[model samples]
Target chain A: MNKPKPDLSVRIGGLVMQNPVMTASGTFGYGPEFARLMDLNRLGAIVVKGISLKPTQGNPTPRLVEVPGGLLNAIGLQNPGFDGFVRDYLPFLRHYRAPVIVNIWGHTINEYASIAERFNDLPGVHGLELNISCPNIKHGGIAFGTDPKMARRVITAVRARTRLPLITKLSPNVTVIAEFARIAEACGSDAVSLINSFPAMAIDIEARRPILANITGGLTGPAIHTIALKMVWETARAVKIPVIGMGGITSAREALAFIIAGASAVAVGTANFSEPLSTLAVIKGIEAYLVRHRLPSIRALVGTLETGAVIPKPRGPGRPCA
Target chain B: MLIENTIILSHRLLKGGYRLLTLKSKRIAPMVRPGQFVHLRLPSPADAVLRRPFSVFRAQAGRLAILYKTVGKGTQAMATLCAGDEINILGPLGQGFPNVRKDTLPLLVAGGYGMAALYLVAQRAPVKGIVFVGGAGADDILCADDFRRLDWDVRVATEDGSAGKKGLVTRILDAWLNKELHGRQPEFFACGPNGLLKAICKRVGRGGWDGWISMDRHMGCGLGACLACVQKVCKRDAAGRETWAWARVCTEGPVFACRDIVWD
Candidate 1:
């Protein structure tokens, strides 16, 4: 029997990726580190580490703390600034076949605009993944992501300056995530990636203090998979643009849940840290799932949420249906 | 540059909480040198979300060994690995020891689990050399037989006097230096706890000895880009500017010249 050629290609914004499997920002540092472990060319796209207008020292020691099912990291925004990124790291990324998405962070609104404009003209640059959801730093990291209005302002400023596709990464810390999704779409963001790490804390009972140097850090991995799914569902339904979902997608089955919830593509974050070849595992899992279900392409799975699918209501006094 | 072979040799208990896992990969072995390490994927699919880094304890033919103490779910899952089980393994990564001359009197020092890294150096070192080991007690001591079989002069020190000498390994080292048994100044190599390495560095002082020490730090990419595994080093480039540069232990080295390291 002839095995079916898996159709994993996906399109987001103006870019057409060979597959929906992309490395999450921060988790994958420019994609070269894992090149020895797996073929970089096999990936759909590579999201580089977060870049800033100026060099950042990031957080102090004990920056990472391990929890029950995830990890908390307060690694500030450590980078060599935009100039260094373009001059030093850009050339290395050009060697790979996959599109390179530069994850950018800034201290102020103007900083985002200026850096976006600079990256807009760089060769081999695919798009900009605006990291507006970083929670480790004292300023501007989570500031834009927490407030819908401020989120709109930052995305708007960057969108006006660059022709490059804009991917606004949303933080799950906010109460009304759907509202934030609407605000980002209205402000001209080409697409949106939902649910950056959740803010969390871990304590060392023996030491009688927090495990991380920053006292608190952003939690990521399987522990928050459900939360990420819910946020992606709400945000994807609220916006017309594509939503790239990520949380604790360790296998193909988990990633399919995000696609069903309305995500166009999925990013593998903390899972990459656990396995050097996790991206490939996810790709293989998705392919196996497609073959098992006899689906022709991954597109057939996206936004396939069944209306009749059971929706479990919160366990409390029932209110009248809207 | 390629994966020649990969196999799970054995997974067994080391101490009460740790497990020693031996994996065989020839592609990595051919390129591996002392002080380099490989990143192993933990078996847990959810709870542990990062590939744990283990020092290259011993690499030969197509096999490499790693001694890890299971302090969490990730390592505990690693302990469950059985022979023939396929696990993801990345190369004999990071810069290793500078190829020493045949005549260099290599002196190897290890403390506790630090022996995981020093074991390889002892095996590969010149036929005539000495190895000093330190552990909390006899139970914590590892690979004493391996070193003994190699015909290298093996010195053991346990904190509780359950082994060879009573007191810290550094004290044993001081005695060796004062006695000057070998008649020639030895080139020292050490990897262990930070506290032990710090004490050794202080005793040796600047311009006193020629040696290299391996450092351990939290790593993100295991590559140089993340800057998460930065260690202070006194480096001099082409321009002769003696500056403090952040070196990644995963890439630049898990092994560095003793004089180049900035002890804090």
Candidate 2:
């Protein structure tokens, strides 16, 4: 007798995915770029790079620097604005079955709302991933993601503009990630995704300057997986809205870790650069894991972490130092 | 593009720290075009996380070759690989050089290992023109013998006066264009460090010669997803209005028109 397959489908707010494996924005350039290397239809969802109100030229050369277990990138959210994306890329992406998630950013709250409203009537776009935490940009990105008030204001304004599933991507640069996650859920954001690359910088000693032309970039890959895992776990516990986990997801083991830590879905970021089929491989590996453990569905494994110890919460803001 | 683990058929050390590593891949050779490159995953012990990008120096029957210099940690690790070893590769990536008319003369320029990309162009060239190559010394003039065999006129310049003329390669090209070309304009092609490409852009812009230059940059995904390797280009819109945009070097081109490039 043939065994039945495990249920891999997952739901992120209104967006239904065939599986819980998605390609992170910026890493997976608007879908068509990786189409020749792998089948785009097989992905859980394709989150394109951040699109602005107008076309952006991005930073100058030497935009990337590879470290031991990760990459530092200051690509500056370079994308074909809202109109350019719809005209040039959306048509090709419409051919694929995967849900198209448009990751967007802007210099102002009005700009973010405007871009979101524009994609509302667009045929192929399934959701909007608000990129308020991109470390590479000069303004609006990390600034909004770090402030709870700004995060609330931006999500609230954009929520009124579009009925599309709103995903507020949180920043690790914040002091309390759970607080921000709660703010998004309170503001009517359908779901929240997080751990947009940590704000980082690499220096060239001889040149006495930064490695990236943008001076600083977002640090991502396996190097930051553990940190992301902790943040995702805390954020998931704080909100009822689903949390899409991402940051240094390279393999099924890592993706599985995020699921167990409470992420509804996982996005493969920097890994796509090294291996184009990493998402597919992770999907297969997760299925194999499910079958091996006799798990009936992917939902059965979500937030299944069993921490044996119960540490007492810290009391009072400031106690006498010993 | 296909990804496969290929066996190293041979590795030869050339002058000036350059090495030619040939891989035995029956699947890749037939698909290779001029200006296309292969992304090589080197066997590094530490810190060299990304796969190195190398231009297709030469591709022949059931084999492909990459010419690289040992300038840093990644190349240093690549230099140690011996024949019979296996290395992972993704290729014939990016758009290659555009086809030229058989009747037009083609002038080729290269500096150091930049010569690697032009040999294939020179090989399939219909009308051969002069080859200008500049290096630090005599040994740095790579693949000159290969061009001589192809019956293309080769000119050499070295900074140390170890070879033909002493000075920059752009000087040699300028002098030749003045003395030989006169009123006749030839198609130009170049690949090298940014400085070399910038020089060609200036000369080509002033002379109004039609040609392209291959660009090099630190790339993450050689398939254009990463947007890490972008070149500023003067693009034309549907209304024929000129606009400056950052184009992907991996997809739009490693080869771009000389005039299209927005040189600094």
Candidate 3:
């Protein structure tokens, strides 16, 4: 009478991930780069670096800076472009068991839809992650993601182009993240991933200039994990579409924080730089925690936060009357 | 690419704050090439989150060595490590130097600890060539004695004129290329500071010598995933218009052809 394994499989949009741990885009390269280091099939999904319609060289050198608890990068979404990725990278990626979620971006709304339409015909790609909120790029990155109308327009346009599941990666720079999340859901988005790296910069005083060549870069790591959790909690309550939470998730405990806060799944970002096998370790840890808690499935933990509905008035402290 | 716990065979203090660390890594040593590097995950978890990338200085029978200067907190902590300590490492990563013809003369130039990556390249150099070692003073020129021991020609240059020739090593190279090697254009190989690399790349591009340079950058993941270490690369369009694009220093190259790199 052996106990059955805790069900780790979870579905986001239409893509059913074997586990809830996926590698965030930009952290994981096209695929073959990390395949030798870790078993790619074990991952829930592989989100590669953001792709554009044309090959982009990205930013200048000295694009990275190390802060207290994180890293800042202005990589400018450098990629091999859409056609190059399909020809050079896609064939090697097709061999892996993991589903490939192409993270695509563009400078204009028309560009976003056109890119989405191209990926729609690609054979190996399972889903599309719309990177409408990258802070590192100067053009339409955070532009469309921050504004509600712009987010709606881009999501609606992309939704019309591709039949694949769409996940809108939202920016934390917005005043209210839930508003954008709601807009995505209303505009027919299949899912939403929150808290892309926050805008940050480091200074080299002796050099008398910013540490990053781009002057400012997106900050990602443990420093932003707590903020992501808060945003995930709010966005989950706002939209019916599954919420994928990520920001400095290095371990299973930190990832579980998102699950408890109502994230259908979690993506490992900056931690991948420190430990290539971190995402696999996180998957194992999540399953172990479920088994330890006697939970049958990961869904049981989603949105289980107890907000203390009935607050008892302060009774004895300082003898204050209510 | 193997990640294993490697035992430090020896940690000797070299001149100019450099430490010649020898490690017994059976898994890594055999695969390492001239310009490849190993990512060392320091033991201190609280301080060093990002693993430091050190170019493979020398590799031999079941052992590899890295010649590193203690500059930042990561290298400073690396200095405190002694022999018999096991350190975690991931390597022989990035593309190594391109193979050169056995008959071609190999001219090697290095600055500071950047010499660490060039020693292995020089060992395999054919015919006859000169090794240009430069530093702030004589103490900064690493592996000069090692190269000479191999019966290779060695030339030294110090900024303060405390060693062989005064001024920068690139200046010495310029003088040699213009004056002595008038007819023979030796294949150039260099590893040094960005300014030094820039000067060398410019010279090689203009001088018409086959040249390769090993670059150094602040990297997050020594592997290609992080996209942290980027350099501008020169590319030509259909119209032959020169254009520049970002190239990952960790993946596309730690070593690149002179024409491939666009000097700023």
Q: Top model by lDDT, which number?
A: 2
Count the clashes in each prediction: 4, 0, 0
The sequence of per-residue lDDT tens digits that candidate 3 reaches over residues B1-264 is 988899999999978788999999998999988899999888864534588899998899999999988887778888999899999899989988876567677888899888889888877655557888899998898788888876778888999999999998988888888788868757888899988888888888787878899998889887887777877798787799998767778888899998899777
Docking class of 3: medium
Q: For candidate 3, what is the TM-score?
A: 0.93
Residue B236: error of model 2 in Å? Answer: 4.0
lDDT string for model 2 (A151-179, tens) is: 88898899899989999898999888888
Ranking of models by DockQ: 2, 3, 1
CAPRI classification of candidate 2 = medium
Question: For model 3, what is the alpha-carbon lDDT of residue A241?
Answer: 92
Better of 1 and 2 by DockQ: 2
Candidates sorted by TM-score, descending order?
Answer: 2, 3, 1
What pairs collide in candidate 1? A273-B50, A273-B51, A274-B50, A274-B51
2 or 3: which has the higher DockQ?
Answer: 2
Residue A137's C-alpha lDDT in candidate 1? 86
On DockQ, the candidate that comes out on top is 2
Instruction: Indicate the residue-level lDDT of A164 in model 2.
Output: 93
Q: Give chain A TM for each model in order.
A: 0.94, 0.96, 0.95
